[model samples]
Target: MSQPNTSPSGRPATLAPLFKASAGDPLLAMMLASGGDERIAAGPDGRNRYGASARPEAGEIWFSSSTASGVSRRGWQAASAALPFAFSAGESEDWFSDLRRRLLNLLAPPGAQAVFCASGTQAEYAALALAGARARPGQKIVNILVGPEETGRGAPLAASGRHFLNSAPFGSGRAGFALDGWEGAAALAALPLRNGAGAPLPADEIDARVCALVRVARARGAHALVHLLDSSKTGLSAISRDCATKLLRDNPDDVTVVVDACQLRCAPAQVRADLDAGFLVMVSGSKFLGGPAFSGALLVPGGFAESLAARDQDIPWPEGLADHFAYFDWPPLLRDRIAGPFGARCNSGLGLRWTAALAELEAYCALDPALIEMAKACFQGEARRQILMTPGLEMDESGGEPTLIPIMMRGAEKGAADAALRKLRRRGLHLGQTVPIGGREALRLCLSAPQIVDFAWRYREIGDQNFAFGPLRADLEKLFTAWGALLG
Candidate 1:
């Protein structure tokens, strides 16, 4: 491995043998294979950065701490340095302008306040609160929630939440929703769950029912629950256009759309189409936005945010603040909607890191596109091909439309998956493994960050007996490639 040539930070360029060397070839295996790497020493880029972690092959690993550490350091500095506009953002309009302009171009929406929050969950809560701000206290606020019905989804419903219209069928009564297959979307819409409940319908046939959900809302004399739909997970692109057509009609004014773009930075362009159709865009920097887990943002559409802002004339909440939404907690910023229009941010170390990471990413993405494609074609693409080995390793559909490409070994014997995992660990390779969709054991090979610049060389280093890379290489090839060798 080469040391950083002219790096003032004294950081080594390649993976260090003692700290990074695996049983395989490369001596300097990065921590978060692609997206994040924590450098023991500094580099020319900065003392903290380790350059986008998470790139790996079938037999390598990616670490998180590396890039996370970098993002944290830089973001903290930038955010802390920000003029702490607790009340007024009279001067920082330019900075916010770049942010706002980019958002408009991507979301393709007109009139939006690109505001930052602490995290995605907070963004969701804030979006809901903003929506619920319209509630006339007993004015039926039907908060429609669609997701796996886990992890803070219930927060909004509890607040002015009268009808939790599950866009899909759910098992657990705790706002249970079972919206997975196309059929499920239809079934839930068929019976409409009767606002409260009645005869539960199955989604087996009426798979396209999700489209008619608006009709259900109208019938129940309720408004759209602002659809807490996170498109990052659900591939809204795959949904039949026939179903979403009416919803997609350009009516940014009539309906209230609050999108949880938790996986924003990594998301493709079409995602903006969804945001453009909404009254609010909730972006979280943690997931794919390349920031700490804490910092998130709420990009509110146009003048609506000011309407929801806490003002002198507006009565304080709990004077109508629902208990369910009491879970939406943030150090309140007393911004008068009328006094000044601006982005009110929380004092968070992670928040600082998020801003810096964004700046870095924005810069990197502004390079030569053809060169970028050529580089990807030569590097990561090849690595991906190599990792999808072994016929039985089935890739599961990631909900968040994950930047991490995940593969699950389906129907493998109880010890089979674990045995494979152990073998990889011995070889100094790690994987993202978990209990798969149907109680199945799975392993995911993600190509997201600190990458091996010389991956091809590492691939060739296998089985050089003088080093450990050789034996481990044989072991892995035997596990999967042995069959290929036999056939060959």
Candidate 2:
């Protein structure tokens, strides 16, 4: 097969194949088919409406991982390599099992298991299914969602056990309908991380709100699923890990805490710690991991799945989930326990996405810890400084990790910020979508694993002095210059 045509500068043309295939491979086609409604539609130019293409477009500047990112070259190669194993007859099951194991080995502790989902929102639904399955007869699952405003738009609906979007990622269901067997099985209690003024609530106050919600659930003999936000869109953590640990300890039978680390800005150590504390962790490879968009997983702590399997009571599989999850999505121990008619199938696109993500993650994990920190610090510090110095922009001071910087547009009208974003796009620069902060909307400048890795390689080549005056600073200067022109 001939390689897809490229421009003189080696950038892929608008209608280039998603991969380097001369002819369309059915397995490769599944990569684009694995996501939700949003992933399926593309404009005439062969890019999504968001102006992102499945293949890497070297000409575009991407700082939009907080929203979505085009696949990195490294990730694309990894996915391409896995095509044979994924397509091999009878090997698909083992392929998926291997993927689940690889992910756990890299991101979780011993005995941990994972179930793949197409997106973070679907992972929320998977968590809900698990919580619901464990609930005693007549017990309501009280879903305590932290910082819903700062998370995915569909997250609250997923927490309530309904389809977050109009179309399911895999299965068939109308939006707003309860998952099969989940009708009236759950209730939602939202705890906004920020106050009315858009300032993040104090950790103590946030902790109190979580505890109060759990108390109310307990009073009603409900099962409490506390959705803790490790990092939000603007880099805010709503509840402290200490609070989550105490809640689980105080009510071991009734409370289940799940960490929403979807942004994946924190260290791997943090994820392990959450699993160690007996909390479920949800992460997205598409975010800070810098994989192609729509890869997600629900990390199950050691002994959790085993315990669920050991229960003598009948654990009825939620029929509604059949549309969203496959039989092999769960670990072997629980697969048979889930009495569903769904066959042993999996999402090929999801497997490919994770393959790409693991490639990026392994490369990232191989770097010296100090070097990674240095790159992150330098990038964050430089970005913050530039945002402060730029006219018509102000930074969000609610601090978490420095990986994502959200900046507000000063004195801009309702549509002006969006217009600036489009202008930036035309200039070959992309940023995170605007997020509503208190009364204002802010655009996020995000860092990804590939970006850091690129810096690491350059830093090694040029040494300290030249590295300081090199591409990292130059890129930021260019970004801010384009940004400033739009504001003017």
TM-score of 2: 0.92
lDDT of 1: 0.37
Global CA lDDT computed for model 2 = 0.79
Candidate 2 ranges with C-alpha deviation above 4 Å: 1-21, 24-30, 33-35, 89-91, 465-469
The sequence of per-residue lDDT tens digits that candidate 1 reaches over residues 1-488 is 11112212222325223332233212112211211112212344322322332212244333222112223333333443432321123222334434445544444455555544434544543554455454433333344444332223333333232223222111111233321211111112112211122112333222244435555654555444344344423222122223333453532323355555554533334455554544466665444434443345666644555455543343223211121121112212322322221122223233233445464345334444443333334333333444466555555554423334444555566656556655554444444333333445545443222121122223336722224233333433443453223223
Worst 10 residues of 2 by lDDT: 1-10
- What are the TM-scores, per candidate, against the unseen true structure? 0.52, 0.92
What lDDT tens digits, residue by residue, belong to model 2 across residues 1-488?
11223222222344345344654444464465454556544556656656676667787888888988877888888887776554441333677777888888778999888988878988987788778667787688999999998898889988998876666656566678888777887899998888778888889998998899999999999999998898899999978888999999999889988999999888888899899999999999989998877788999887787788788754555777777776567776666566664533656667788889999888887777777888888887888889878888988878666888888898977877778888887777888888888888898998898888877777777578347436777878899989998887
Relative to the true structure, how large is the alpha-carbon lDDT of every model?
0.37, 0.79
Write down the RMSD of all candidates, one decimal each: 13.7, 6.6
